[model samples]
Target: MFKILFQLLAISAAFVLTAPVNNSTTGISKLNSQQYNVVPFGHVDLDDYLSNSTTFANHTYLSAPGSQNGLERRGSVHACQGSFTKKLCITGSNAANLVGALCHSISVALEIQSGNHNCADTGVHSVSDQTQGTVYYKYKTTGKGCTTTAEPGTIEGALHKFIKEKNQDKICDFVCIRLTHGGNWSGYVGLGTSQDAVKYSRCDHEIGSWSACVNGDKGDR
Candidate 1:
């Protein structure tokens, strides 16, 4: 699991996309950002968390017929908990630790307070293209009440920074950006300088459109 996260996070020079500048505007909110206090990472019930059905409502598919780097995802979550167990093949205390990590990554991605969803709710729904070796993740987070403040180290905050730095929707791709060492229990708000590393991550959105990273604010379905 950790290895997979790193591979997804690393900025590769191989995959190239003819990402045209997508500066068109939408109904997304303003970029006024402030530190948001996010949920604290705590002991998680791996079995219970993995029990909730995850929503496949994230991942904006685009039609880049010939584009290599921006290949849109197809289909839905092929397999979940059963596949997850088989994919990792662990149990007991070891399984617990791994599940914790998985939950932590997804929670940070959506700034979800610990109990909102479960393992099945946050597990990896799909792997990347079989040929391209790209891993795609589908997630849902909300900025419904975020007037100025957002979840601590909010991916949305990361989104604001990403756009300011002229990022090309890559921050949403890195598994590492969405992950951290579990059991830290610290309530940090931002990714420290690692936020810059997030730019190296990849987000595959339509090149000419602007979508809110959050579902409530402007993430048009």
Candidate 2:
């Protein structure tokens, strides 16, 4: 009886371990493999982030289609880029730590382009062909409620700084911006600059049309 029971347990364990992983049970396996692999956004290195698409809905602002630096994406729809990889992508912030460096670069770009000096509210801007008409604004720091003070200089400089600083450490394959719905609404405020890299690393769904992509007074989504 002992021998028979031991054999049965072994067989059960082996069966559980060898079973094929499917998307329905484990969210990790449901990634849209083809789109993430074939599309070219900022760099091919981003493929590592794309591989885990199951979690796309958690961090980013939007996932559009198109190529960056002359490489074309393979998708036709306007869905989030990598919602399937939430569990894996949380391992890294992708490019959150380089904000300081990018801020400095933006200061310089403002001087060169607009001939201004102060780096107060000099917000940055970023856009990929992925989102056909949308352009992203990367702000240095916002006012009391994620609002900008004034135009520091050229928006491009601010954005250039952000990209440069971000790329220095980890290329930004995914970005998350926050929004503040005031008046006692309960929701996540924002992730900190020094929090665990993957804790709150999922993209959001606050996308808008290209014509309405400019920053009004909203925080990161």
| Full-model lDDT, candidate 2 | 0.25
In Å, residue 190's CA in model 1 sits off its true spot by 16
Question: Candidate 2, residues 77-139: lDDT per residue as tens digits?
Answer: 111222212221211233332332333333333333323322243322432222122122232
Best by lDDT: 2
Which tens-of-lDDT digit does each residue in 43-162 have in candidate 1?
101111112223333333222212223321221111110000012112213232222233334335444443343222222232222233322233322222211122323333222322
**In model 2, which runs have C-alpha deviations exceeding 4 angstroms?**
1-145, 152-155, 169-171, 175-221
C-alpha lDDT values of all predictions: 0.24, 0.25
For model 1 the TM-score comes to 0.20
Prediction 2 TM-score vs. true = 0.20
Least accurate 10 contiguous residues by lDDT in model 1: 77-86
